[model samples]
Target: MTKQLASSAPDLPHLDLPHMGQVDDPWGGVGEGRLFTGAWVQARGGVIEVKEPATGRVLTLVGRAEAADVRAAAQAARVAQVDWAARAPTARAEVVEEAARVMGGMADTVVRWLMREAGSAGPKAQVEHQHALGFLRHAAAMGQEPQGHILASVPPRRSVAERVPLGVVGVIAPFNFPLVLALRAVAPALAAGNAVVLKPDPRTPVSGGFLIAQAFAAAGLPPGLLHVLPGGADVGQALCADPDIAMITFTGSTGAGRAVGELAGRHLKKVQLELGGKNALVILDDADIDLAARNAAWGAWLHQGQICMSTGRILVHHSLHDDLVTRLAAKARALPVGDPLDGVAIGPLIDPGQVARVDAIVQASVAAGARLVAGGTHDGRCYAPTVLAGVTPGMPAFDEEIFGPVAVVTAFADDDQAVDLANRGQYGLAAGVIGANVDRAVRLGARLRTGHLHINDQTVVAEPQAPFGGMGASGNGSRISGPANWDEFTTWRWTTVQPTAPAYPY
Candidate 1:
């Protein structure tokens, strides 16, 4: 396999991973260790060849997880969760806090691997690292937060409500923003005393799976409380259907989320879903076009526009559409797109399939009358930043989440028309409205249906302690992180007691 990590990255939170009797010195990733099933155990489903998206080069071979592995993990987590739940809240918090400390020290190593595995740009990878640290620290604080509430009861009677762990939580993560998204669920669940079975997207097992395992293990998290299984659809289905798993937290496309929601529903499991978005960035008539164009470029091209909150379409005032289009087109063509290791601003997508999908959207939008203002080309998997003008509702560029470096621009006459256009699709994930008049922008944003909105900034933003989720097709409104963790990772237990015994009404 490729050269191992040179003495860096932790193993996991209390994982018993071993190669023979010891793990490889510089842990490259979980791929270097096969699979993590309380240990570095090989999966029964055989091996998968991990490849670099930019070069399509075989990076390493990792054992592919299957349905059986998911069951075994659930069974183990169910048993281990009792002890994890029994630990002092401080004890649980310490583990997560320590993981964050360790993660901070190994920033360079993690970013390097993230670049190789997910084809992420340097700044984008660094953002993931910092955001993950925030998630861990935020989750750590949840342990010491108020656990329950004192209730007002009639004299001689006492009643109270407290949060309790859900026993076992399943996390199904996506390739884009894998580390932060997986940790957004995994860290909080652990802090709240729920054992987790994390299924990283097969394409990003290391950053989303193994890297987490390593960090927690080094921090002295108890064994069997967390298991990282890198696998395909069967494993995800098993996780949702397993009896031992009490809940599922998922982040992916709307189509995949529907499937997950359907399966979890059949089994009567609590589910938290964060799905896709075709968000809008509204440039108001009174706004500064130059500043708006800069934000649009960053939102539309950062990490190749793979982020779910990336600007899917831009709505500009008809008066300034031409000027904004000219500025955006120039910015799009200037962005360097290629290997992330070469220190470029944009990189190749996760794979060739993503490239094909991006190309199809561009071609279809142009065919439907959207003008290709700039860039409509690709070299290998690297799609040049593209700008489309005159895009409208029926065009793919306007309606679809083009998870690539492409900016689709549409124009509107007033705030009502802008809000109507933003709410045209099923996506209600995120949106942005920028203008010189902050009050007007806020008023318009308030009218929009998105779960999150920016009055003067871009759509792509995430605060670790915010109520991070969406509504409609974007999610089932099962918000995560911040105060939402208590809702997702724990169930309420209302207890009542009398001095002796309750009087029977018989």
Candidate 2:
């Protein structure tokens, strides 16, 4: 909706995004052909148009939401939560199972839609759907397992603690993982018998909301149990500040997370946040250059480095600095780029604005005397995967979270220096360590500040068994792992019974 200056192409890497199809031209952020909020209603003066990064193809335009509408939606969700929670656990589980089956039927169409709407590559978009399905199935299974309790013996009495659902839960999700993150909140909330008020990013609502609504309907959830409130900050603020909402779970910037936390604190409601990360990828002296290069590339470019756990900063041993940069640069340059639908390695950014922001960050880093080693050109919203070397600790590329394809590489003379440098950031989300010596890798991995550390590998996604959350700025004390997820959604009420009356203590 706001007009900024158009920039000339910057000199960096030669990244090419494949031409997938005839994407619409953008106006404000509403794509010309797509049927969105603007299409359904009269054109409001201010609209932010989302464009494909690679070809300047207009993807969608998001109109600003009215605050009044958001309040009404939140109020509606609060009214519906009680009845939804009263449903039997098995009944809830059956709905979750049915959601999975419904999602499975529409998998292909959903993947393609995500590719167009979110600019996600085929493989990655497919994985989002898979994650959605997994969350649904896992939640259903969890529901079947009855709430557990511990027994205590005193005099001749019995005691037990049972889990019960929290009331209306507000879920504010991010754009990077539109569908997957939505399911993450929905599955657990529903399984624990809580109703959810979902505020998805307007950027990719159709792709995310359509699938979720379909799944909920197929699962036989109550009509008003889950409400989709798609809009921007106004909507989010309303939901967070509302006293009726029992809890708020958010995934986004630290600033936004703080705001949500403040609002929840004021209401004395629970808040779970997964915030920013300037995650580090530490390459030890013993790491295999070839494998490390491959892993580092994946860490930097997957989802265009939009992931919360993305490896934005690279800490390498000084001894192998040149070798590491050369390998990483070569691998990055070699990756095929173009259309997301064609299954290219890198797709366009969610919108042109993101591409511009990422490009500016890379340029500013270079202007500050950091060397651009490889990949940094922009065609519309499409930016080539870039590598930066000769970076020092104070540089923005090293100090900040660059949620883009660019990775900053800083050389460390020894293991101690590498550890020190990696721990310099405010974030403690996730990190990756590369080494040939198993013992050294294991030992050094323990020293990293991140909550999730991977040894000689890059795949560190959420697993049903493993806990996922950060230590410091990355999150509050919350994790979506095993039974912990179930615990977060429910509260424990201790109940005591007496077979025979106990004597009073004198």
Q: Quick one: best TM-score, which candidate?
A: 1
Positional deviation of residue 97's Cα in model 1 after best superposition, in angstroms = 0.5
- Tens digits of per-residue lDDT, candidate 1, 243-330, equal 9999999999999999999999999999999999998999999999889999999889889999999999899999999999999988
What's each prediction's TM-score? 0.94, 0.86
Residue 237, candidate 1: C-alpha displacement in angstroms: 0.5
* Model 2 alpha-carbon drift over 4 Å, by segment: 1-65, 153-156, 498-506
Which lDDT tens digits does candidate 2 get at residues 1-506?
A: 00110111111111111111123421122232221221123223245454444555555443444555555555766677777777788888888888889888877666766666677776787788887788788888877787868677675677888888888788888888788877787788888888787777777665655457656765677766776656678778887787768888888888888888997888888888888888888888888888877787888889888888888788888888899889888877887666664557788777767777888888888889899989889666778889999998777888888888887889998888888988896789888889999889878879989888888886345665456778788888677645777767888888888887768897
**Model 1 Cα displacement at 222 (Å)?**
0.8
Candidate 2, position 385, lDDT: 85
* lDDT value, residue 133 of candidate 1: 99
